[model samples]
Target chain A: MLAEGRIWKFGDDIDTDLIIPARFLNVSEASALARNCFADLRPDFAASVRSGDILVAGNNFGCGSSREHAPLAIKAAGIAVIIARSFARIFYRNAFNIGLPLIESAEASEGLAEGEKSRVDLSAGTILRISDGARFTAKPVPDFMAGIIRAGGLVPYTIERIKAGS
Target chain B: MPMTITEKILAAHSEKEVLSPGDLVQVKVDMALANDITAPIAIKVFGEIGRESVFHRDKVALVADHFVPNKDIASAEQVRIARDFARRHKITHYYEGGDVGIEHVLLPEKGLVLPGQVVIGADSHTCTYGGLGAFSTGVGSTDLGVIMATGEIWLKAPPTIRVNYEGRLNPFVGGKDLILHLIGMIGVEGALYSALEFGGAVIEAMPMYQRLTMANMAIEAGGKNGIVEPDEITKAFVKERGPEAEAGAVYYRSDPDAVYERVITVNVSDFGPQVAFPHSPANIRDISESGTVLLDQVFIGSCTNGSLEDLRDAASVLKGHRAARDIRLIVIPGSPRIYMEAIREGIIETFMEAGAVIGPPCCGPCLGGHMGILASGERALATTNRNFIGRMGHPESEVYLGNPFVAAASAVLGRIGAPGEL
Candidate 1:
């Protein structure tokens, strides 16, 4: 099924320190993490977030460090998808491994205003911006990756496969 | 088709022993690591993975850094969990702050890292070991957790990019300067998922410590690992490290006619000190471009640049002069070994005499958890990697990245100055 959410804008190179600082790593409880997501970058990020919001960012989003806390913290904080111009290699895998859907669109970041509604068709590989009627093509998540995400993260997905004796 | 160093190594390490770009290779990992910040989660995931024994008990390293001395009660508990896991697993190398400094520095000092090894750690700066010619990369806790269980990871053998550096470096221009210069040339996305190889006369001339500085920051350019083929310098470093380390001293070279996705040639003599401004490591500026940073604080530490050589360089700038009255200068040695060496060489005393507060060899303040963090709206220059906004303490504080000389010089001037200016 296609998923959609309102857009939250962030600039390029939004690092792990901003997404989920090291100070918070000690607490692995996802709910507590949900409160401090983007504590450094945008102080109000936690309170401002909706249950199914999408983030559109500039190039090199999720750069700096391999802290999975960044993605987990975001996913726990109610972010459904993140559409960036590009993604850091390790962060990309971390997000997908944990079932936090991320899309990369060439112009999803450009012409994007905060709070603008975004309609994403995961299968079609298109992100439709409702306000400006802008349609941007996204780098399609591969079928294998899609299956993993649908299974809700690698751990549970792995468990399901093992349970099915596959 | 010619093979790049990264491709060649992955090919040698893979099960099929023949790899192309994007092939998921599940090879036996030489080592797996995680520090204080990452270990707690890694332990949790390791438990959840339902594997009591790791693939290789002797292939794991756990270090307690990032918030040593237990910044808070919670941080102490993370260190506790890490210690318990290390003991229970009978890890090959388990280090806590007493003798351990940063994981990057401590691993090499303890002779745990070797050349040509493929090392993965939960911490991103795990790339620091690339200086040893190892294909070291960073992964998330879940990935590390899986490795902790199965001792293998699925990875695409990346393409290689060789940097043939030529010419002699200017005395003032150190390895940190060279890496910064490369990042400035390549920008952030230049080497995504690629192995970076260092070759040429310049690399051959570089000391092990200096070469480590260059390889450690390959991540800044988005590369998987920045590696230098082990040579005489590498041989000496490993030889002194003992026999166990000798096993890991392998080097990979591209086939003479090997084709590369990208080849960046750098003339070492042409570069100078580089500073990353604003919020990005890739937002680098040459020291020759702008001479001053109006900095109020100067931090000198991180696994990447916090070392004996790094502190020695900072001491050179702070030898006779005291830090400026308005500026706060803090120096953190990378490891306990480096810390002891600096103390013995009087480098630590020189920093103290010059008004630089010497902190224990840990990742403090560099990550801005504790130590010399910045206040809101204040500007500081640091010798560590990454200056993303709010990385060091106050969210409103500004961070500028440069070599140790620039940081020391900034401490003396109460503002950043080009090399030797202080």
Candidate 2:
């Protein structure tokens, strides 16, 4: 799914703690988590976010602790894609596993304005700046991951695979 | 081409006869684990599956850590459910206070964990066992519970990220600090969804126990696992625990031209005991730089910092002074084994005589469920992993996170201080 959205800018290493701090960890539901996404690092995040927004962050968008709640919260909060210079390992996997698109583009973090709208082309592996005609190449997803996305995430894809064999 | 050890294990289990990065495969788990925090939820989901339990009984481990000596009914009930579930499922090797330590520490130490085995723990630190050459990772409770009942889970093999840290460690700068430095450079997610291969002189120079600490924190930076190539140090670690653990042991190295999604080089000598201020482990600062933080308590425990060496470091600074009367210092050994060794060496008595409370071997104040939690507006310094607000107790309580020496010196000053300042 291709979507055009404004940038939600973040600084270096916006960790899981910033996204959904450990204090909120006891609560397991994703809906409750949306209230606290970037609550610590950016207190106004929830109010500032628009539907189908893209988070453009300087290095390490999701780092510190393997809390799945972090990405689940961002997805529930209407974030379309997270374009970062780098992604923390576990969160990257968790994001894609849950069907959240994360693209890596250095310019997205540096060149894009917070309110700037951008088009993320999943199949083309490109993020086009609608406001500035700037284009950035996102690292291509491996063919296997592409299949999981086509199948709509790990749990659904896994269930489908198991059922197909049965 | 000769296969890597990881490739061998994956190929053996792949139904498609080929394994590649991001290829989701449901393979057999060598072991599955859960702790007090994650176990209850896992049990709930495992029961929901309505599936018959087929997992090997001996391959599951459960440890009561986070809220041990239960401070409240929620934690108390969490353990009770896990305790009953462990029994119902015939899941033997459930380790508690005396036999139990941090899941990461207790697993490898008890010889239950072996190399080349695929281990899954509901806790994030499950990746720690990769230090022993296992393809270990963490998952959510629902995922873990399914694996518990079915003995299988899906994995999307990640691209490798190789970090070659070469050089001798500066004195008293432990693996905890080094990993913190790496997190700073990597910004926590540079190695996302990848295996971190740690090699070169710096890793080799670290002892087995230290390597375990490093691996445990790998998950903190969002890695699936952090692995150190098995060496003589690893062999000695297995041998010292009174068992031949080599049967399941395996080692992996990077190909000369092995493609890495990212490669980071770090220098440990320049780094010192780092602390996270406010919250989040990534809020790192050198110990010496945090000269003005006032303290209410200093904690030394958890699978991460409660080793013999860590205890010794704390005791060294604490020998001459008492903790500030208002500041509480708590030290818990990771395992009963480490506790026994520390007692024999008089570390426990030293701490006790210094007005520190010695809790049982368990995770305390790290996840902030119970024991040593700070009060609102009060401050404390800790050696635990996360320093996130309310992570060690009250959401308003402040935690200044540091390593053992920094915590100890801060304990002496009743505020944050560098190691040698005392």
Best by TM-score: 1
Interface RMSD, all candidates in order, equals: 1.6, 3.4
Give the whole-model CA lDDT for all candidates, comma-separated. 0.81, 0.75
Query: What is each candidate's DockQ, to 2 decimals?
Result: 0.63, 0.23
Model 1 misplaced regions, further than 4 Å: A129-135, A157-166
Residue pairs whose backbone atoms clash in candidate 2: A87-B189, A88-B189, A88-B192, A89-B192, A89-B193, A90-B222
lDDT, residue B163, candidate 2:
78
Residue pairs whose backbone atoms clash in candidate 1: none
lDDT digits (tens) for residues B1-422 of candidate 1:
66766666666666765567777777667889998887888888878767668778788888888788788888898899989888887886888858678888888877787877788999887878888777788988888887887767768778778888888787578778888888888887788888778888888888888788888888888888888877788889999998877776776666788776778889877767778887777788877676556778889888878878888888887888898898888888988788888989999899899788888878888778888778899988888888877888788888888888888877888876875665
Supply candidate 2's per-residue lDDT for B352.
86
Q: Candidate 1: how close is chain B to the reference, as a TM-score?
A: 0.96
lDDT tens digits by residue: candidate 2, B178-246: 877776677455566777777778888778767777777777667778777677887777776554576
Span of ten consecutive residues with least summed lDDT in model 1 chain B: B9-18
